[model samples]
Target: LLLFVYESDASPIDTFDLGPPNTDVTVHSAISTAELPNTTNTDLAHVMKLEQQPLTTCWPGRVLYLMASNFSDKQKWVACLEAAVKSIQRKDTIVRTGMFSKTLLELEGSRRLELNCSFALCKELVLLGADEGLFCVNLYHGTHAIITQLTGFKCVHQIVYISSLNLIILITGRERSVVTIDKRMIHSRIDQANSAAKEETNPIPHTVIEGIVGCTVMDASKCHGGSYMVVGMADRVLLMKYNSEMKSFCLRKILLTRGITL
Candidate 1:
């Protein structure tokens, strides 16, 4: 095997092939250069061209009993199975096409301890609730904006989108009390960012329900086409529903989990 390595520092070549007896000919440094592709670009190009190799390509008759005697053989079969499952799973995932293809946008700002995400009144908009504040992203235009008035919070526990009421209900707080902001006012501010947005805005009106306040909310979800929502706490599950005017969320019931002592 022959290996070719390009040297970066090129010294002047001193060769004695003159017409006279012993004349030395000196070559300039610009005569030779080390020209190679960037290491990162080469790696990314290699990764893009790579494809998964199936285990059955070598072993012909392992369809019935997929058994392996060694660890390396087991890993090959696992890789093949994972690749096959991913191919089948992508077909079941939902996709929403825009006016054009998916655009890649580079994010500018930063956030600490990202917690939850919820869809806005328009399906294309996404609300990202982090520990610092709430950030908005327009999926259609691929733009990001921060809701200035929605700051000064401990931690964002969960975010749920109530599409029927055009509201984004999110829970935030670490201990003592969990604040729930269920209102359409925040949605209008996000919508206004696209049409007519301004600075120095007032605080959005919201209510705080105490059913799952002290308990740590593990997860929050809203039923499809239903007026009810469920919040999974550390020990119990909280069930809530919107009022007739769709203004505030009232606790309907709580499903407590039985605890056992060791």
Candidate 2:
């Protein structure tokens, strides 16, 4: 390892090679060096008396004595070096513990191959949307089932689930329109798929929320006695309200944004 010191502006001033011939032992406090009978470094002893603890990189072949400007600085250096050493000692264990992966499914051989998919999660249920359709996977029981096949969608770009209203909104990339589905429909399909113990199935019904087209991004929230949706378009933003009686979102207000949004 190479340790470097930098100026306040981050310009490298000095570097020490703490590898190979210079690094095989533990670092020790400067006060421990004062107790050594053969200690000849009066500077280190003096620094210890001034409340600045020093450290020695006591390499097997050579020793590099280092001192900090203050007690806090010394503690920081000691803590960092000790942490680095601990990290090196558990390098393999750390790699093994930190890395993980799981294969969900193979789509290459299936005709229902998803293209440009979007994903959303609600508790143990995972929602996946593609050009072909929307799918729900129950992680608890390993049930993968289709919620609905979105009609005329070239690709599903974004999927948002509003738990407050138990509704899901999907944005189509090519059509530039919004599709809404009930969360109850997803759960019902998962239940049916789990009982049948199958992978593929017919889709549930869905409603395409019309009028609002050229949608860039959309989000919904329920607050202050009502549920609202904020939909972004090429030149404007639509603030729509959810009408529970109609089971659809209705346009409420519009705000013009001359430029595109994030």
Candidate 3:
């Protein structure tokens, strides 16, 4: 694919050739580096705080997702990575470039962000897991703003949206708990935060998995469109199944690696 990094759509800065597609399909499936298994391992302390800046968005700016309107489009998540890199690179250099934005959203103190996941149930909102807690950034009114900040979670590592179940899964860095939140509740909270009579609401509806003070959750994700969920921890990889009868997540099994010391 040809990637064009331009000041504006009318003016082009540079073009990058991404070479020939590996297959005729154009886009390839990939996995994140963190998901790969390795012998080496280290664990974080039980008590550690993270620092971060406010949430930000670059939807149509430097970072853009060229998604086909059709839901079945195979290139739904395939985007222009090289073009975005060049645009941001120019801005970081001596060149006074305005290819993108600095911060679409801002807040007090450093909002050290750990992980972020997007929610499309209602409006376009980004759920940011940070040192302070869980923060939601809304993309409406032509502004990216921190709508609400949910406390209690000292360090949140991952947040995943389960569309089929209409659930939001939160993984803590130290607690090793998977908290479940209803999508409707989040929508209500964000809506209330934007209204005249603002009130704080509990975003998490129930504790799917709890009281595991042993291991820390490293990462988590949903599969089969929320039918199943998986979490990686310091000690083991947990495979959780969604119990439709109970309407909660239940630990199906734990896969642990044995460490060999010579």
**Whose TM-score is greatest here?**
2
What TM-scores do the predictions have? 0.46, 0.58, 0.51
| lDDT (C-alpha) at residue 155 in model 2 | 70
Off by over 4 Å in 1: 1-115, 118-124, 140-154, 176-183, 191-201, 214-226, 258-262
Ranked by TM-score, the better of candidates 1 and 2 is 2
Model 3 bad stretches (over 4 Å): 1-102, 108-123, 141-146, 197-199, 202-204, 211-226, 259-262
In candidate 2, which residue pairs get closer than 3 Å at backbone N, Cα or C atoms, i.e. clash?
A: none
lDDT of 1 by residue, 112-159 (tens): 335454445356656666665565565666444333335344456567
Could you tally the backbone clashes for each prediction? 0, 0, 5
lDDT of 3 by residue, 54-164 (tens): 123322212112323343332333444434434554444442233234455555555435444434444566676765567776666334354567545556666677677
lDDT of 2 by residue, 232-253 (tens): 9888999999898998899999
Candidate 2 Cα errors over 4 Å, as ranges: 1-92, 95-124, 140-154, 194-199
Judging by lDDT against the true structure, name the best candidate. 2
- Let me know the TM-score candidate 3 reaches against the reference structure: 0.51
Error of 1 at 206 (Å): 1.4
